[model samples]
Target chain A: MNLRRKKLWMTVTLAVLAAAVILIPAPALAANPIERFVMVEASQYAFTPATLHANPGDTVTIELHSADVAHGIYVEGYGVSAEAQPGQPVAFTFVVTESGVFRLRCSITCGALHPFMLGRLTVGPNWTLARAAALAGLAVLAAPLAVRRETA
Target chain B: MNRVSLLQIPWLKAALKNRWPQFTISALLMAGFVFAIVAGLVGTPVGSRNFGIIAVWIAWWAILILAVVPVTGRGWCSVCPIPMAGDFLQRRSLLGPNGGRTRGLNLRLPKLFRNIWWQNAAFALMAIFSAAILTNPRVTALALIIMLVAAIGMSAVFERRSFCKSVCPVGGFIGLYSQVAPLELRVADAAACASCASKACYNGSEAGYGCPWGTFPAGLTRNPACGLCLECLRSCPNDNIVLNLRPFAADLEKPAARLDEAFKAFLMLGAALVYAAVFLGPWGNLKVAALAAGTWPWLGYAAAFLLICLALLPGLFWVAVRLAKRMAPAKPHTARRHDFAQAAAALVPLGLAFWAAFSLSFVFANGSYLLNVLSDPLGWGWDLFGTAGAVWSPLYGSWTVAVQVGVLALGAFGAARVAQRAGARGGLHPLPVSGYSLALTVVMMGLLL
Candidate 1:
């Protein structure tokens, strides 16, 4: 094929590949009708289960318990927060309205590494990871062809 | 071409030519350093609440990564406190020239040990122990004290900034990345430098000492080694030194690239990814391994960390480069490895973006402590700033997500452009070289998102 044609073909192929990767349908968020319950134990420097995964529209009722000193949970994006003392559990509920990862951080001054003490709330149908991976593949594949066209 | 020389501004020229501004800044930073060390030793042990940790890791580190390196290349180096004590001791003057006689032995650094290997090693060592260092004020203090003593000792033995040039871990990476910063200090005219007989920039003039970072400004092109001390500006007899505000990543366009620098790039990219996963990711096991000392899991973590940083990432990159070379329009006359090494510069922007994005995640999420710590730096219940009781809250919230994505995209584009330019200069198609950059973007996006 001619150089122009080759470049055209490569671009189209990249676009199609990227589209295919992104459109690889995972199970949709908010498909389930059940409420999710998880117990999160916060301590001086770490959270028990570092990640909590759920789907959009699912009610996630987290029972926050302090392993050591008093600690609080501050869920990002969602304005839900609570404080729990040692031997006392504080519960809070929030519906995952967004389909992305949100940080759940300690609101209290736990200890030395209190700042980094946190967890993740991954509301499902997180297509960003797939899309990013696909784009990367496309970029790698198309880059050489694009450079060739430039040089040509 | 998109640039104006800062020296053209009369006030800027006057300020740069004078020693007072830089001297004052350096002195202040040194004082802060001393305060940090004292506090780390005598005051609060809590890393989040301690002045030493909060000031150094939160405020200073956030600013350094987010602002200083991005806007002004090597600007921090000009006022870094590590070298202040050494410089003062060597010159025997805080703000004036020492009559061309330094108090130190003034010995030349050994030729065999030159280059950034020492810095790479030092940085690697630090990265291995960063978990411990970041969480403990005492450990942070010890590290600072060690660096200070080492800088002083090196100054006493070797001539002019041997420690910063060839030893400092932070300086090494900062120097490497500073190539992408718009600000640069270069001689105005090469002809003037060549024709002049005095060579005052290298050997001290009455106004200033010799280039402290052991570089002759006449031949300097990259920011990796130049500390931006501005000694050359004061010492230049021919009035050739000019500080230019040029386009970013100007130095990355240099015709030749080095393996050490390429390796540094890989190390940086890998470290940023691993740090993100360990420090920010929802992985408790990883953090445990990273933070736990003298355990099998910790050893495993360290080994994996080093392997990933030093080998796995580079190894993957090498494969990508090899694939690109095979598919390249023009076959390279040089060894494939050499070409791959040179092409590694293409990914520098992406690496920088990774660091920026990581810093964004880290600093924003934890930055609220700065207000509280400022008021209660020692966590001794002393509300010095009256803002000590400020509640912990992450800054910017989801706003950082959008900004990080934009930054990564810009970095990818820059990296691609760099690869194309480098390829054109080397009589090759640049596209193949961009593969690594594109792939790295994916990784960065994954981490950041």
Candidate 2:
């Protein structure tokens, strides 16, 4: 019973640590209190704007549209993810606290070269993190309507 | 299984003994599976890089389930990955009122929520997005850890047999398919059981053990809710309930009636349907949006569920019920319920058939993944065999379609055999309900497989 209780405590501690690791980024990579826009287009497992530049403390929203199949916009260095739709546009938003070059990739299972789907994001000074985030959000909000109008 | 040595078939005797070995292999397998997911996040398996999620799952599950069953009987139930998390909460052994040892302090589930089909539906929901589930390290890690913790906790708190029979999906499959096993535990005498007073099957006394599944040995079939735990083997005084040497695929004399058994059929049917619609269906919209809505998947899934229940299930059931009514015009109405149950039970064979089909697909589809594993044993890349994902590499690739078709036929044969064993007594018009239901399940699986 003591062993089990200990095990349970360990599990809880581990879970908490894991959650912290995921939810809270490093102090250096402090979240941009708010984010702005960063629309990335995905085609044949590659993002259109393969490289992005932004400032720390910015909440960047990424509006993603897939040209071929299902593609996930994943920011590895910052633990960011956005799954893209083939026809419709999908979006994800995250705060950029850490200033560094974050490698992004398509996490969705597209096809042969799905693994090669790559991009880069540089977060540093002169970054209007909140504005970039707002812009990203606005882009996301505007996408569906734009798509609808085009289809209509 | 505790019987005379069979020199004739060494394999069958071994199967009966190892029918269940309290497997911890799955915990290990799950650890590897978890590692794979982490690999996906941090690095990538060059093998699975080009492979579909469905193919990977199919390949792994096929090798595991098929190989495990023939050697271990119903052992997989103990280690099934899907239900391990649910089992902890679903346990019946927790403390409760109106109880000395409460039958179950089990999760007080709703009536509709009781069936295995519900579990199957749950599995379908997971499987549809299993790509993300399998690849995401955080998700996979959480799932594995959850399962490990739940299993250990449930085992510690609950009585033996309570968790496995009721909660796990893999266990559900093991129990359902175990009826096809060659060996079984059965009472030597029904008359002896009626006269005996200290029914060890129920109230297991100090002298003899009781059936943990809450079943009487005399009343038990092969491995219905029985966990193959063998506690009763020690408890019986008369030595009445003996494990018998039966033929291969022997438990066909009766149809099963557990909600667990019923759900597996639904799971198999649902799995086949999901794959077809997702991969081969004419719907272009779902295909296009398959990626975008990964985080929140309920949208597409809700639509799929509606399509299956409101449409496909009804269509199949209607056609089946009609044909059944026609085939067995002479069968009694009481027998019809039994027939319906049996037909539903026949889904076991159909389910197995689909496994074979899926296995065939794995050899073709994910066999590519294996090549990467083979060349890069350490996964260092640069194909040693020079045929990494070389399309024509695997030998089974030659006849995958043919193998699938053959498996479907075998499934039909197996179902007919099961019907006969279930006492269907299929004459020219033995029991139309079973024939039709079995036929429909087979036909649908055949097309889908």
lDDT of 2 by residue, B1-449 (tens): 23432323656534433424323454565555555555434444332432222223445566655565533456455345443343324334221211113233433334554455644544555555543443333344444454456455544555534445455545556666676655566677888888988776566655433444556777776664566555455566676656655654555555654444554665556665555444333233333344344434546664675566345754564456446656653554544444445556555665666665655543443344555544433344557786553432233332454455455545554554454334334321324333443454444433332
Q: Pick the candidate with the highest DockQ.
A: 1
Q: How would the docking of model 2 be graded?
A: incorrect
**DockQ numbers for every candidate?**
0.36, 0.01
For B1-449, candidate 1 gives per-residue lDDT tens digits of 56688888999899988988888888889898998888899878878888898889888998998899988879999999899878878999887886567888989999955888888888888888888788889988999999999999999999998899888999988988898999999888998998888787888878789889878887987887789999999988888888888878888776346777788888888889889887877666677677776899989988998899889988887776676666667775777667767788887777888889888987887887889778887778999878988877778566797677656666776677777777666544556556567767777777667
Highest-lDDT candidate: 1
Q: Give the Cα lDDT of each candidate.
A: 0.81, 0.51
For residues A1-152, could you state the per-residue lDDT of candidate 1 as single tens digits? 98799789878987788678756766665377569999999876677788888888889999999988999999988978999999999998888877788888888877655666768888885676666555555555654565566457
Model 1 is docked with a DockQ of: 0.36
Against the hidden reference, what TM-scores do the models get?
0.91, 0.56
